[model samples]
Target: MVKHGEEGLGFEIVKAVLNGDIIEPITFQKVKDYCSTSGIQATETHMRVILSNSTKNSHSPTYKNYFERVGKGEYRILSEHRRQEKYFWLNVDATSYEWSFSDLKVGRSQIYSNTNPNGAKRKKETCFKYIQIGDSVVAYETGTTKAITTICIVENKYELDDEIFIEFKKSVDYDLYLALESLKANGDLKDCDILKNHRGTLFELEKKHFDIIRRMLRTLNASGDNEQDLHEKVKQSLADGSDERRARLAKRDSVTPVSYETIVRVFKRNPDVIAEVLMRANGICEECLKPAPFYRKFDGTPYLEVHHRIRLADGGDDTVANTIALCPNCHREMHYG
Candidate 1:
């Protein structure tokens, strides 16, 4: 807390100067200029004390973490509450826009077609008007391949006579693209403007939606040999089917050469063991106590599988004492569920 006697015109000056500049570092002279413009009287030392103290600095006297010193005579606002990073989705149609993902990677500003040139000039319903520098942006390829292919940070943005242009910094293109179906399955991005209203070129993405897509991209692009990587790949493969990859596969022969197989060695159980287990169940599942779904076509007997209380692979004997009859549903649940 700023002590009762500590907060003066300098405290107000600091607050006014650092109101909205969260990412960029501001110099001491900038703070001084703000104070002068606002008609607040404060010395340089007083301004420094408040700016340095904001809890992020370990040596700060005040119990606050509002500001962080970035460089010599420069500071930026500290997101004390761990604020979520702002994210935007840009729809890039190569058919209409001359600039491509390559242009963004080379630090060229992207220009989108503007329907109302006068509206952009007047800042009325303009797409890029509210986008500030340092915001995260995901570029989605539209028209043909519907996937998010590039991620970048907004370096600068402006509205021209008939178009809105925005520069990107640290733009990156991942090997994997996040398809629309994959994103929708991962999060509630279907509600976003890009899907709900496709006419718009730029749309604000919710933090949750952004987090989901970013995580999937990072996990897919992660380089390592781990169990989790395999699981993520399986999940991603289930969710996505790339047109190019599918086309390549379609050309190849459907049946490929058989390779080595994994066969589990098992003990040959006595026929009487299964007979005894089935006889004990009396046409009912031992687990769920439900009757068998149907009778066998050949024998007219209840359909059931003899399940060992302890799996045969786990060293259980092939005795009736260690076996029970289960319907197909219960048998599948025992193995998978």
Candidate 2:
């Protein structure tokens, strides 16, 4: 019987090179030995081809020089992230994963996953950093079908790779396997290998498949959940959710028109105050300290305008102390500018 591993032979070679700390380029023997111990069945000639083909002519299709050739028949893996096949799903099973990730409650939790294959781990602690915020997670219930479980919200504000927080919504149903079955039955999931029983803590799925899974999850609600309950919850949690709170913040920033009338009391000017202040100007604009620009058409005086030092709208008294004669330019500035 042939032993099997999910990653193919070439990938294992890269893993071996990464596992090594030696300064010298990885030789054929090191990869061959790693493969043999790891249950990788391949011919010595096959290993030669794997090495030679990885560096030669750059196939750009299969195991291309995504690796660096250091010396004759010696190479190092480059673009390790690209070398690993990107998965369409991310596994979130903390119990089996031994608290690899905490369940999100009220919208935040730190996410972490085991770094395997010895190579990728050295590059980064875990595959957890590969997942960005807003990326969907397929959380399996602890000690169960290794299936979908609950909805956990990733906070918009998270410390990169270290302090990720997720909040679990109140919709407490965990029968995501049924939803999975529905997806498979409707030609949704079975065609995709990402939905299968993949080992390791973070099973990845494609964006499209993840979107479908999220849509399926949306249709499910917790026991005794209702629209009224959800409405109140959303209202209450608005201050609590970063996503919704950000939306509200944006809404607040956006221009909004409000209509109302204020009943501010008007102070009857003493008329004497206006006369005295205007006289004090003496054919000059008191504010601009320049002679009046033009004579008033009606009064034929220096045309300096009588104005309030402080606007009545601001609760300033209608007294000479609060008045300043100004030219039309300065008057307009006082009123509008």
Candidate 3:
């Protein structure tokens, strides 16, 4: 415990500075004024010494972390609690909007045409103004919100006489055409209320719920992509393909005719394992603690290859606990180092 005289003096001074103002971020002069009679004497050096002593003691209750330096010599009383920035999840009805998830499929444009509700096409009943750019959009089946079908990011909104035209930057649920039924098969859908009721609505969602959606979509899409890539690679290696590289490889072969054989093996890769490890690493190689060497050509996500700490060929299960994100150099080092 600190002694009660000069040793404990700065605590009172800090308290005065904190409670002195109606609002926080008070001027340093106000702090000094409020703290004038708390201690022995008032001089330029004494004031600096008290503040310096108080802030320097980080373990002390009157530490500088309790306050923030906003302006020159001005401090703000900072609250102890902090939270992430809020983002909203919006609900859009397929029946009301005259839209479908099919419109967001591969190679489709980013525009979505939403029709105005009957008798709601006037200048006064403009609730469509509630939606803004950068909000999330979720789709439900035509008549009910019992299930969420798709998700998209708002890009632009244009209002016309009988309809509202909304554009999306990209959709997380591109390949999903009415996914609610499948979701119901996995989990109970009766608990969703906001998802069932609103049209042109923006309701804030918890981070956990948002992550639930993101994880499902991210893993699903990545698995599909990896499967496609594997197929395309096999197809390119086959000499019968239309690709020029296959023909060139065939021509470059020696006089002993080589036979082509197709061997299909199941690639049991866990999408969630790779996705979670990469996200946790945040594009830095786990082995080197450096940023990835390059970005992916398709998406701008930093290219850190996922590796298994225990070799999969050695009977390791595909799981995040057994996986890591590493740059190409570190990955090669792991195998051949």
Which is the leading candidate under lDDT? 1
Best by TM-score: 1
lDDT of 3 at 252: 52
Error (Å) of candidate 2 at residue 109 is: 0.5
User: Each candidate: RMSD to true structure?
Assistant: 19.4, 21.6, 19.2
What lDDT score is found at residue 272 in candidate 3? Answer: 41
lDDT per model, in order? 0.58, 0.49, 0.50
Model 1 per-residue lDDT tens digits across residues 138-163:
88777655777778787754434435
* Candidate 1, backbone clash total: 3
Whole-structure CA lDDT of model 2 = 0.49
Sort order, lDDT high to low: 1, 3, 2
lDDT of 3: 0.50
Between prediction 1 and prediction 3, the one with superior TM-score is: 1
Question: Candidate 3, which ten residues in sequence have the lowest lDDT sum?
Answer: 256-265
